[model samples]
Target: MNALARRNPWLVVACGAFIVTLAMGVRQSFGLFMRPIGLDIGIGRDMFGLAIAFQNLLFGLVQPFIGALADKHGAGRITAVGALVYAAGLLTAASATSAFGLHLSFGVLIGLAMSATTFVTVLGAVGRVVPAEKRTLAFGLTTAGGSLGQFLVVPAAQGLLSELGWRSALIVMAGVVSLVFVLAAGIAGKPPEAEEEGPPQSLSAALAEASRHRGYWLLNAGFFVCGFHIAFIATHFPAYLTDKGLDAKVGAMSLALVGLFNIFGSYLFGAWGDRWRKNYLLSGIYTARALLIVVFVSLPLGNVTALAFAAGIGFLWLGTVPLTSGLVTGMFGVRYLSMLYGIVFLSHQVGSFFGAWAAGYAYDLTGNYDFAWGASIALGLLAGLVHLPIRDEGLVARPAA
Candidate 1:
């Protein structure tokens, strides 16, 4: 598998993309379950939202360690184990009869599963295989896989909920997730001997170096905002639309549109990353998110505007993953890409915890999501500004002083 990766890197990218598609695709569908599960289980939106929030939090908390393990062992074994655990989480979620059960299944188990299966581990595999010049584009293409899953799976999930119900839908999803065990074969080996271009840095050395770098923390801060925006929108947008009196299908479609448009956005931004400065591109994406939210909230609620907003936001969505990961690779090299990027992703998930939970809390208190929307705008603008001072230069270029 390692030899095949060297000979044909695109294969590794394709397999990695599929793994993310299954993982994120199912994840993206969870929002659809919120209303139904809340009604059936006698829980409020706050409870459901908290569970999802915890999932994001644990997901981020464990990534650094998971990435380290993947770095030391290999992505294949980690991903395979994650696939089984993800299936178990889904099956367990189906059996959940209370908020505690939901938290145990969806929050703890699935969170850990995501750390193993999603972008951090997958992109690390792709980074080692693809040539440096094409890495950003490859990452973009790979990131697009999650969007593609959103595009394809959210609607399917909605249909399953309507037809077979949430429990059965999750069961079906578990069956789908198990396929990753097979795809794992593609990304199935340790980093090749030639993959690392320099004398090796110890994992502790990598962590210490990142801690001292001002720009690295800045990246973490910016990504935190990104997490907030995505989690708030993905988890609550459907419910928000329903609050506006639109049908539930509109909410599902809106999310699907987000996935659909993001496919192009991910590719374009990735291609752009290879040519232009990544930090500047990141700033633009975040700033655009702020503007989009402002316009979305200011306008009167309607189906057309709702779907349009989904398309607009979706295009800007997930573009951050590639550019941010690219910056880490450029600064530190791919030898520890999984671990460093995992640390950055942990910050993103921390923000996700707030975005998911706070919106629900606000909604429960105020009967509307206005506060969450306002906060998202503020954070987006801050993120846009924060990226400006980041130096995108490689590690060797930094002064010892």
Candidate 2:
């Protein structure tokens, strides 16, 4: 550790927290623009959905490479570049007049930009700085920060849209994202030197090694379900609420509630992972999501019910983050956390693409969100079952003391 790292680990955490907050807040705000942007551009919801789907797809495809770069070099450079691209993408999105422009700005640019700056980069940096004993909790804290962004930014963006139009909101948000560049600078400090045992494996070898681990494959499969549930709800819930004759603000607040409650839930679950079987905890979270979605879909749609559902389901939202990342660190060690976690996140983004696009397509075909909701419930249950058999022990052999 350097003098700054040795003296002030909390400072590093704060820096990481700020970066996560900015990155997630901006990303989450994208949903607020969906309906308005579609109407203004004279495009259908599926067009906007496809654009966001491409964003998620590209985001996932590039994340592993970005992670490798971060692990090899440092997070600061990648984060800086991501912030710049993200800002430019948002600015371009604000001026978009056609479907192609929307796809270029929102899909390609924002998606590729987010690959560098989101949870993979921030969590990898946190995993590097925090001690082994407190790693899970540290992961929780950073994940909570991202959730906090979701909580704060979504409603704020909605309010902005209510006051100014969506285009103006995007312009303002672009300026705010530029601040991430400053936070990225704080992550320039060096990571702790790897212990002298054997040299760290090349990125390709490390990836190949993880590929052979059964637990890693299980983790990826389970995360796919998470992506499906989150993307479907986040992208389409507002329109769903409107379809039910509820106020649009209710939909926005539902998203905000998920973000708010998830802050505590993520921290609690993260701490639980450190003390219990992480795979079991993940299984429980998924099961809970299944039950919650069942009840949410069956209940009569109203403000009270929506808010209650949001809060209840919110507790399970993003609770997967710490445990997922913790599982990777536990199995592989933190030496290559960035690369390993990025590959896992790729599974998540692929699922996100399906979840986001499918909801719009299904709704357009059926004129209701019922099919998407049903799929979410089924996938959640499947995720729970899939993770039940994962072995959560470390990969390397331990010497007898």
Candidate 3:
């Protein structure tokens, strides 16, 4: 083991966790700003949703390339550039009055920035440092860090928006994201020594190999549903609550509840992924999500029901992340984890584009989110069925020791 891994494993996990927290925290807060930003700029909800959709699209598109770069070079430079770009995007977004500016700031810039800083990059680093036996738990902890960020930052952003103006809130968030530089710096140590065996595989070859695996495709397809469900709820739930004649704070609290409850949900699922059959567990999660969404949509809109639904759904929310990544590492070796996982994540963002944009589009055309809710249910069931056939064992190589 290298000095950093040997000397301070917990410290490494903490630093990695912090990086994920900052990256995901600010992104999650974007939902809170949708109404204020849209109303202030005279932009339609579709316009804001389109920009966020583009952000998700580009974030997914660039992730594979960024992950490849991190695998080849190091995460430090990529993370530093990502932090700078993310901050600049938020700053520009704060000043924007046009739809084009929103697309540029929130869509392209923030999307690419998040591609560099989020789970693929951070978790790749964690995969390298932590032992194989502990890897799933380590990923679980990192994911929980992101959930904690939502738990804290969403409520904090709400307070800031109430006290300071939305523009000021954006500026404050940009400042908060700057702290990621420090966390990235701590990850700048040498690559794992075991990685020095031979020339790294080209991105094309790595992708080709992953494509040949049935499990990889199944995982990619299943993850699309996860993204669709998360983006739809995250972007639209607040508005949904308000449309039902509840206070805006109720929407915010519902989101916070999702984030808070997910902290435990992700960890529990992740631990189960390590000890049990990951594919079956994933199938169960998707099936359960289908049932949960059915129940949630059926219930009359109210504060109590909404909050309970949020907490219940939130527990299953990002729980897919760690298991999905863990399955990737299990099927393919962690040698090309970043690149392979990035490709899978690309599917996720594609689903996100449709989820975020479609919810807004459906609401605009029909004045009800019923269509989007129905779509989520259908996709959840499809995902559950698709994952059931996945072969979770290692492809050709023996399981990692």
* Top candidate (TM-score): 1
Q: Model 2, residue 33: displacement in angstroms?
A: 1.4
lDDT of 1 by residue, 157-200 (tens): 99999999999999999999999888988898987555665776
Clashes of each: 0, 0, 0
Q: Which stretches of candidate 1 lie over 4 Å from their true place?
A: 397-401
With a 3 Å backbone cut-off (N, CA, C), the pairs that clash in candidate 1 are none
lDDT of candidate 1 vs native?
0.93
Candidates in order: C-alpha RMSD to true structure: 2.1, 1.8, 1.7
In terms of lDDT, model 2 sits at: 0.85
- Prediction 3 TM-score vs. true: 0.96
lDDT of 3 at 358: 88
Per-residue C-alpha lDDT of model 2 across residues 144-185, encoded as one tens digit per residue: 887898899889899889999989999988998899898887
Computed on alpha carbons, the lDDT of every model, listed in order, comes to: 0.93, 0.85, 0.85
- Candidate 2 shows a clash count of 0
lDDT of 3 by residue, 298-350 (tens): 87878899999989998998889889999888877677788889999999999
